[model samples]
Target: MSHGQQTDSERKPQVTVVVVTYQSRNTIGATLDSLRESCDAGLAVVVVDNASNDGTADFVAAHAPWATLVRGQGNIGFGRGCNRGFDLVATPYVLLLNPDAVIAADALTRLLTFMEQNPQVGICGPAVQEPSGELQPTGALPDPWKIMLRPILPGWAERDMRHVVPGERPQATDWVCGSIMLLRWKMIEEIGRFDPRFFLYFEETDLCRRARRAGWEIWTVGEAVAEHVNAASAKATGAHMMWDTIAEHYFRSRFYYLIKHFGWPAAVTAELGELLLMTVRAAGERLRGRSYKSLGLRLRSPILKLPVFPD
Candidate 1:
């Protein structure tokens, strides 16, 4: 199969690109355009639009008619939305891409070749760089203790505590960021789709952890590079304005991840650390004449009541 050419069988797409979009009208076009560069490689594209009021769906329909658009009923978070898109893929390989990320013209081809050469590797991601060309730390495994201590500890100390370090050479990792994940179909069949319990954050970490536990190797292909507009969709949704809400989701997901993998003790310790951090933040905000009520409430909310997770 070559770039932009449809397979004769037509029943099997070699690669399926799944992009989940939410209020991404401004960036989705460029993302689709970049994917078009690799369409000849027996590629199938699916765009799952999470009920964007901004006509993001309509924009995709008009701009990239080649992509099958799944119109969501409401704002399903990234993981769930990706699962929805996955339901439509029959390809052997699926690439979970972000609407604000653009891969190099040959990026998909390089990733496919790498995966073909290494059958044991189930999931792989490219070197993610910001639009300004700075490398993004998308290849780190989640460290509960480090995450809990990040706010209180210095950056150097936390760096030392982390297990995976991003490097130029291709290497195995605990998890790759969800931004541009290329996953083998067999792995998904074995381990299952992403956990819906995680709405926004830590979902990818959970997926990678599960994959690793299932004996699948996660890798980073340095040759395959992507430029991501970091947090573009989140910013569009006013995530910047609702710092408390964002922090709430992050901490809730973090607690759930820790509890599931490490145990209740770890989760409890993490929650306490977060509570202390939020209390100090709220106090400072109040002293500075800023609204601190939401932060205080986040600190007080029961850990079990956090969104989308079971007790």
Candidate 2:
């Protein structure tokens, strides 16, 4: 690197990275190390451990003592944990990263530079790939009808299509994957932080939805790349053993997201529509000589039990 380039790099905007962990002992270290390489100066990392019995907090305390660790009172969930870490950040830019995601030093700097250059963009993300190097969905906000159709329709019907990577180019998008997002502090201050009601899923969606409504543009820079281990924390945690409980949280959060934005009528309609679609799918499977094993799981979700308005 030339001396001029090194001096220019030192002038890049400061960034604060917030990583919320839940039984993420297996993955958090690599994530922290990646962040360390992501910047030589002007970076603060906050790790909020949500009562991980797996010694995730202790590991952070012992190994990455340079990071600011906040031990949560309990398993307060992802959004709440991020909020806890966010409170400690005073930088102009904030990066919310998953405990199992990795971004190269150049990629992190590219994202920071992108945001700095495009002042209109409130949030930006890199082109993300799975651990296997397969390109993941850039980003797409799901359609309510498609979410309701699920098994009754094609496989892609309910899949997340929220945002996308621009293929070695930069483009404006509505939102980006929450796994690794670079956010402008001013935009967050104007639109507020992640909604705490979302214990797990849909929190970032909710925040991005608000960002769009607040007239903030979200972008995805394809030149920057990130690797994400999908659901690493969720799978490693006891949540995998306690899937039913986890499913309930997901369904309830989904329901709350639907109702909060689209209102009660849409949610009620969606719940009934989904049940109807599942029934149709089950009948079709039975006629085709296959048993629909997921019927019981869907029924057990108890999405109807969630309130339209917070009680």
Candidate 3:
């Protein structure tokens, strides 16, 4: 098996997987289990635990003995955990997969094969789907000025499949969700790793943008698919309080992303827009005599089950 290591005579895996998990006890096993085919082909995998208190590390250690597990002192956050795992790898290609995501059969092989055949491509992502065979929403790269309209018209953000044609080959993409993305080692050596400052969201987008800026093509392979149980780690935390819920992290990360790429003034405007949108959404819900989440999911900020706070 490609366990991230091989003797001189043994064939090595061209790609390694890095999975960062936090409070993912409910879904980590399925994610690992889904890699059976890839693991058999010598695809070494590294699993990082960002201080999961739910015994997630123990489960990975005891259950997935083949995977190299990195336990954290505390919740180092997703980006940092992925960086830690990436530092330990030397494979030509690396995949950063979410603990809540499960790839379809041979999905890793296809993604790795695609990256190997297309050396110009630095980062590639699978077409995300739900376990029930539904196409999950993945967004195109955010436009600095255009994203401001997201608060008013949610669909202003670009769709993930905008560049894709159903029966065609892998197409160029601005960015893909961090849920299941493959990276080139050389790309990292050239452009650096995921921005550690981004605790969770937008870190992958930052990495993708950097790669694009470095003359590396970002792509999405429709043929390579994965089932993402979107935000299972965050849901596992069972945080309901506004400050404790993933919304806090999600919004804070969103703000940082806006400021880093755009500017502080733009980021502030976006935040205020979010507030206005949320208030409008609340008013609509009142008229409907029903409840809806605050500033609900968008192609730009597709958060699942945020539960409208104080629920």
The lDDT values for all models are 0.79, 0.80, 0.75
Over 229-308, each residue of candidate 1 has an lDDT whose tens digit, in order, gives 87654556755523534666776677788888988877788767756765776688779998656555555444644556
Report the lDDT tens digits of candidate 2 across residue range 1-311: 75556564556538989999989999998898897765456578899998899999999999787788998778877788888888987889999999999887889889988988999999999998876565656555654676688767756783545434435788776667788999999998999988887887778888888998899998889989888887544656634422445676777778888888888888878878988888888999999999986676788776665522222
Per-residue accuracy of model 3 over 1-311 as CA lDDT, tens digit each: 56787686457677788999888888899999987677877778999998889999999999899999999888877788999998789788888888988885577778878988999999888778765455654446675455555545666554333533223478787777787888889999999988878776778888887888889998888887677876443446753323245555676677777888877778777666666676677688879998755445432343322112111
Clashing pairs in 3: 2-42
- Candidate 2 structure, TM-score to reference: 0.87
Q: Identify the candidate with maximal TM-score.
A: 2
What would the TM-score be for candidate 3 when compared with the true structure? 0.80
TM-score of each: 0.82, 0.87, 0.80
In what order do the candidates fall by lDDT, top score first?
Answer: 2, 1, 3
Whichever of 2 and 3 has more lDDT, that candidate is 2
Residue 46, candidate 2: alpha-carbon lDDT: 90
